[model samples]
Target chain A: MNRPKEIFMMTFPLILLLGVLSCLYLESCSAKKEIQLIDSEPYPIEIPKGFPDIKIPEGNELTKARVALGKKLFFDPILSVDSSLSCGSCHLQKNAFTDLRTTSIGVEGRVGPRNTPSLVNVAFNPYFFFEGGSPSLEAQSLGPIETFHEMDFNAALLTKRLAADEHYQKMAQEAYGMEMKLFVIVSALASFERTLISANSPYDRAINGDSSAMTPAQWRGKELFFSDHTNCASCHPAPLFTNFSIENIGLEKEYQDKGRYRVTLKNEDIGKFKTPGLRNIGLTAPYMHDGSLESLDMVIEHFNVGGLGHKNQHPLIRPLDLSDHQKKDLIAFLHALTDQDVLLKPEWAP
Target chain B: MKTIKVILMALIGLTMLTLQGCDNSGCTDPDSLNFDPEATEDNGKCDFPNLTVNFSYSVDGQELTKGTTYTINGTAISFSDVQFYVFNPRVAKDGVMEATGETHFISFDNRSIEFEDLTAGHKHMLMFGLGVDSTTNATIQPSDSDLADGAALGPQNPSMHWGWDNGYIFLKMDGMVDTDGDNVPNAGMEFHIGKNINFNTIALEIHTDALEDEVEVTVDVDFAKAFTGIDLSKDYITHTGDFPALANTVINNMKTAFAKK
Candidate 1:
């Protein structure tokens, strides 16, 4: 019995020592093995040669943490004053970042005056807003945030709310190295938005010398678009599909909206409005600044009629006289602007 | 032994926390981040050219003297607030036409010179008459602060932009015109002229040679001559009501003013 006790005392310490060592080893191994919360593959952003480099603001550089936070904020109703709406409320990913409604509903269900434009490739735009009023993406993000009908939240309050949350505070600091400010919040969102480039489309492939990219109908449509019969390329030009210039396409004799003229206050500029890019236009419906047209066919019909019979209408907006096949073909060509890669980005979703 | 064990556990925990914190530091994932190789280089400053335009006018048979106060057909007129715009000026080297620069609103409330030398030649153009071309107008956004505030034009100067409607007032001629029955001091007449559409932009290409050596281009605008095409007495008893009607009537006659004289 004495011998048994001695053996127990000796073996117990040895076993205890082994157990402790194993536990420490396992803990060290666990510490070394990090849980990779983000995917290894980078988001694709192809900048063509000779194009001006896009300037992403420092402190809010594009990162997984920042993008992930922005994505959550975009989908979260917390950004809205009433917790009733989100950016994604109007800019649904499936609908090419545009709402299906003629006009978007804002906080408290107030309808907006203008239609929601697409977010795809918005980073490439040199100017923002319907009339090209906002000069940069950072400046543009502030519009809907404080608009009475949109988020309806003061930017200062937004910054405060973000800073108050421990989770957001940590993420913001990690991404921006400090607590969130209004500029940093918007910059983060803008940084996330800048990554929303759409390059891989059927039209892009065709332009890049891929013969099999476009269908025969789309090919015919492409020809018609560039042809003088349609003359669509005059305004909706190639590459970016927008010259970033405004025009008064004769919507009315005297526009109550005044389009761009509201900004310039020049007489000749009365009815002018910015010419939107045609890329992925098929996905963004209810066309025009007011979302007057419902479909691509209706838009074609409107253009065929040489726009509204207003005197201020653009002289370039002559009658197209496109046939049914031509219209269909034109629509097919527009569909070629859809970038599947942009639409299906898993990180873009909530 | 127990004290030593506690110290060792504390050290392990500290090391783990330190490693965890360090892992996230400088851990910019290349796949998630987009780095522009072009962005490495700095974009140079925006260089705008210098635009200069000079204006002179003749009254009756003689060249109007600089700083001479005179009345054109009984309108007390001074070239005090004269401004200029080039509808689109072409840069000789770029091969691309320069956009309409900011309006150089002249600030001369008191001083007078018949010949006005408008500086910033690369910025201003001598557009014919009062209105900008429709093509240029169509692209201009009213919301553009550069255009709306008249950054080129001096602030608070009365220009023909209709605050009610969305177009520009086509003609703006502000000077004292002798009227039959008007009580307002200065008896100023404003010819705010604009058209929604069907209005033609009279193209007047003032040659570079005309502007060379900063020579003054004479533009003789007779306030009474604006009414030569229309009898205002028959159109309206007074210039008190409905300026648009008056503007419409005056613009119809003003078309003759740009007949390649």
Candidate 2:
């Protein structure tokens, strides 16, 4: 063969091989990497009548996959530092998502400072915690995960741990279209929590044209609750049963725990706390911010006698001098607030 | 064998000629550790040298540590934990401020702060906030992409970030004081100072020196100054908002505490 043909013979196979390899690499680069979702059904939240529309963050829309992922993580101990506690440990479904303990118990028996609030109707809350510190549910989820007495786990480490599991990776991808990241973890959890709407109570039913739903005693208690004598409706109004105002209800004479003051640092906010929704108040026993009041009876008595009259106490919180029978009626009315369906809802459970 | 050698030589020549036509891809920043002066192209992987700042706490000329006892104003006191947040570091040359927008969480354990992006310069003034800046303090959730794991704004163990308030505790000095004359710290004393109003800017004029590419500076923090004019025995607790006067005093004292060593 001629010299040119000999060179061509030597380099043709090499050139073809290089071309094939380059095409393969280019194909890999140009191909759109589609994430295989486990399930991505859009979850439309069923807002009850009289309940305000939940404002979900634009980035985090409700999805079945996202809520499912959050529900799984909420009940899983993998987020804890010791892998011994989960959000479910403190917020049980039977207790309207409250732990029933005076204060919450964390991983390794570490005691939390505040009582576990019910997750029901939490999506309606403008801010989180009794102090109203956190601005959003996404931000509030970080509190339990990082608090020393709670999960005591680092988000970086938790993500790293979750990333190791293929199942978690797939779930995270399905939920967030991303790996198991800090944002995904918090956002997913918030999505699930926002879906925990508890509006199907006896009071809710009675107000919605079902007059037989509420008993006569509960109806009487409702009248007193809305009446000017108690002024309960001032802070805790109807429908949601909470005005969502931060107030000093005169829980103590000298406040041991500075409630809203911790958030705002205002002198007037020193002994103030967010007025929690009365919905599910019956199942969420051991009431008050610190769970100081053990039952609905104790809560009514505290309110009836008027709070200890702290310097910054709300003027509306005064001695009602409610009769024992009136107190019982109020307690019975509170029991009517419990939504039996939400308590046993399989979607909320582990 | 001769034909194979000829082909290998041709391939080697082709490789060298091809390399001459292409630009070398590498980090071109002079301040970076892997800076390539000859590179004509940047691959965007620049490994900048860390500018380290070592903060050593002292109380009355003695090295301060957890459980380190000191007598102040005829009262004995000892600390269990002391932590603070440092952010918005800047090195100035003749009045021009060079800002390194970074925040750091400082405790007794992690006192050596490393700034990866601070460029080398002959800086006469070193300024940093004793607490997080208002913009960062306003960030309730520190999981933002910019706020990394060790960032002062991010979550920490023995958390400086208040989950309740959604703000960082600028300076936390938790300890106990001897109230009953036993010469032992028995009563709890805590100064959890934090808030947007309490963020203090600490500016120090150091001797004119050329800060090397990878410089290390030692700063002495006299924590004893943090308790000046305060009765440690009685005024033991201040969570900034709860006790604004005490918090302001501590913050003002801390502003004067840091000095270049």
Candidate 3:
């Protein structure tokens, strides 16, 4: 007994059940793969070469049943009020889950304030939306549908709408047991979005010691990008190609639409927006929060001049004064970030 | 032979220990809805109930019984519509919860709202939020369980949701009230309150009766009480995000607006 007491100092702490711990515990218990809603195996979320472990939220665990249900819901237009659009209508797989439109159109031909965001590698994001308001994929899922310009659907009616469908009813019973609820619907959708992994790009391979994966011009551009003078890598970090921190980047002298400030309500965060990952960046355009820039050339030119130098702009953002040839090299590197295989994934497409 | 016999005995001991740990397992989480006391291990079988509490729109503790006008402060206030959202109910002792309640939407037309299921041995004191909390307001989704009931043969409509802000309007009181002590009702009292900042909480003690499953605990909202010390002859129309500060007087008066009957 005396020995046990003495050794207590050297021993590990006892496991305590805590509310804070629950929020960080992302994955569900990986039980033996037992089929429920579908005849499918548990989809293992693939961790890319350099990315950290993906933590699915505590309440939501990615199971085969949930993902299958989510896939059906993602493609279904029934989530919309008028049934004129679906999530797939704007977030097309070919464009790497972005509406190629300058800004997405809404119900009754209304134009929205912001651009339709790309969902590629969205699971890896620390926060959701252009302003980085929602912390989880599940939390961000409800935003567009409630927006008058988007699907314009009330969340309360989802249970009735989903319950009416025989396919959804059977699936709901098999996956969650009992009838359809709002929690089940969003959890399923968030799980399906988690399955969208885009790690097969040539740049990813090149970074992982495959010198032949990328062209020589792209290689030269990579040097300038990571170099201190260019100052791209400081914000657009490696692996996911985004540090996931909010920045102003001097988009305007004064913002017509305040970005991160809308969420945070702080003056310093006024024009700040999330640093979007560079993966599949080429496919998803026009760029920026308003989608004001049309092409890679325009984005490069903006950076070359180091933006308009707004007050809160990052210290690293300054005029590179790059020559025409160097700008082309950088644009070529961005194009190499594209992964063609993501577009061909049948399960992701409608 | 001796070595093998000793090994078999050790294996058997380990098996018995494992079996003993697994026996009569149940939900051990204190926060879980189906918490069991005699459980040796947790089996993750936690299920919370949908406890539906109710409300009765009244005038000075007297039931108006629909379209009934009541005279107070020398004005005739007739309410055409009266509704609000309540969230995160809890049974408390001195302010600590004995059980948790679900978020609900209630109105005069449909006064009943089912909350989360209770386990056992909870008392009369209750606590609930007048509107959606900051976290819920920011992260609301369509399939959110907090919604009272998705409207199907029910009056819990989604129109109460603020389509622009992505949050539900916490309270809406639309009626005509005579502000100048005139016999005729003239002023349109459109006081719809929402947004996370304006959300308030109420800690109530149900002194009238003991708590039971599905028992009605009436919370009163008096239009007369809102006009106790102020004139409502002004425009009084509060929008979703604009002028929440202007509606503070009406919102603060709601602290005394609810009482156990």
- The pairs that clash in candidate 3 are A155-B142, A182-B143, B49-B116, B49-B117, B50-B115, B51-B114, B51-B115, B52-B113, B52-B114, B52-B115
Query: Between the candidate structures 1 and 3, which one is better when assessed by DockQ?
Result: 3
Report the C-alpha displacement of residue B162, candidate 3, in angstroms: 8.4
User: Residue by residue across A1-350, what tens digits does model 1's lDDT show?
Assistant: 59999999989989999999999999988754433222223335667543346776434456766666677777878788888888889998888888978988999889987889988877778777777766666556656776667877755466668778888766666555545555556656776787777777898888889969999999999998888888889888777788778888876666766676545546677777888888888788988888878999888888888888676678878787778999999889999988887678886776
The local distance difference test score of each candidate is: 0.59, 0.83, 0.73
lDDT of 3 by residue, A235-257 (tens): 88887889999999888999977
Question: CAPRI verdict on model 1?
Answer: incorrect
**TM per model?**
0.51, 0.80, 0.66
Worst 10 residues of 3 chain B by lDDT: B150-159
- Return the top candidate by DockQ: 2
- Which structure is stronger by lDDT: 2 or 3? 2
* Predicted candidate 3 versus true structure: per-residue lDDT over B29-105, tens digit per residue: 66455678888788878654444456767778677655567766656767777777777777653445644445666
Locate the minimum summed-lDDT window of 10 residues in model 2 chain B. B140-149
Give a tens-digit lDDT track for model 2, residues A213-259.
Answer: 99999999899888999998999997888988999988888887889
| Between candidates 2 and 3, the DockQ winner | 2
In order, the B-chain TM-scores come to 0.44, 0.77, 0.67
